[model samples]
Target: MVEESAENVVPPTKGGGKKPKSAAAAAAEPVATSEAGNSPATESKVPPKKEKPPAVEAKPFTEFIQQDYLPALTQALADKGVSDLQLNLERAKIAIKGFETAPECSQVIGRWNGGNRQFNVYFFDDNIQGQRAISCVDLGHRASTLEAFVIDERKVTLDLLVAGVVLRLNSQKWLTRN
Candidate 1:
C-alpha cells in the first residue's frame, strides 16, 4: 500500500514554493510509478537549490570601533554594574581640549572608580563615520560635552552602537550601582 503515483506528483512551484514539500522533497524525487506496478517509471527531480553563503563584509568604522564597538561597550558597561573596567583603544598624536585634529587619531579611554569615573570616546578623525565626542568625569565633576554618532540616520549595528553609549550612561546616573 505505497500510494503516491500520479506520475509521483510534483508540479507545485511558481510561487507556492515557500518550502513545504519535503519528505526530503519526496526523497529527492524519482519515484514515478512503483510499489510493484512492475517498474518502468522515472521523472520528478526538483530538489537541489541551497547555495547562499557570501555576504558578511561590514566592519570599517575604524574597524567597527576597534572590533565591534569596543567589546560591546565593555560588555554593556559590565552588565550595568561596572567595575575596574579600564578600556582603551588609543592611537593618539595628542590633543583633545575641544576637538579638531587629525594627525592620526583614535581614543576610547575609559577609566574606573579609582580614577573617579572617567570617559572619553573621542575619535578626532579616522573617518569614524563622523561626529563623536563625549567626555565625562563623574565624581570628579567635569561634565559638559557629549555627543556621539556612528551613523544614526541609517542605523549601524553592534547593538545600535552599544545602545547609544548605554543610553548616555543610563541617563547620567552613570550606570548607577555604587
Candidate 2:
C-alpha cells in the first residue's frame, strides 16, 4: 500500500458521519422518546368522517300523468262503458262521445263515429248556438250537452286531479285562465 493522503484521513461528519438510515427505517423509528429513552405508543388517532345528505328528485309532467291520471281515467272510463278513450293533452282535446272537441273553445271540433268521422264544427264565438249546426251525434252538432261540454272543458283539470292524487299531488304547480 502506498502512503495514505491527508484527504483520505479526514474525520467523519456530524451524527458520527455514518450514512443516514433509509426513509423506511427512519419512518419506523420513534416520534418521541420515553422517560427511559424508548419510543412512545405508535398508534394513530383519526376522527370519524361525516355522512352526506340524500339528493332530491324532480318528475316530468308527462311522467306524472302516466303514473297518476292514466290509471284513474282508465278505471273511470271502464266504469262508464267507454271501451276506450284517447286523450291528447298536447292539443288540449278530448275524443269521446264519438266526437273530439278542443277543450279551449268551440270553434274547432273533430268528430269520430264508427269508421266515419269529420271535424266540421265551428263557432263565431263561445255562444254554443252560433256554432255550425250538426247532429248532436254528428260532426255538425251545435250545442254540446252539459256532459259533453264538461268533458271537453274540464278534461285537463280532471287529468290534473288524477295526476295530483296518484303521483305527487303537492309537487305540481300551475296556473289556468278561462
Alpha carbon deviation, residue 42, candidate 1 (Å): 15
Model 1: how far residue 136 lies from native, Å: 18
Per-residue accuracy of model 1 over 1-178 as CA lDDT, tens digit each: 8889786676676785754575777789865565644335232344547998732226565666777777878889999888688887887643444534646557787888788877776766654555566667667675566566554546345676577777766776778644
**Which residue segments of model 2 deviate by more than 4 Å?**
1-58, 91-178
Q: lDDT by residue for model 2 over 79-106, one digit each (tens)?
A: 5343434432232233335356545433
* Candidate 2: pairs in clash: 134-140, 134-141
lDDT for 134 (candidate 1) = 64
Give the runs in model 1 whose Cα sits over 4 Å from its true position.
Answer: 1-57, 76-102, 114-178
Clashing pairs in 1: none
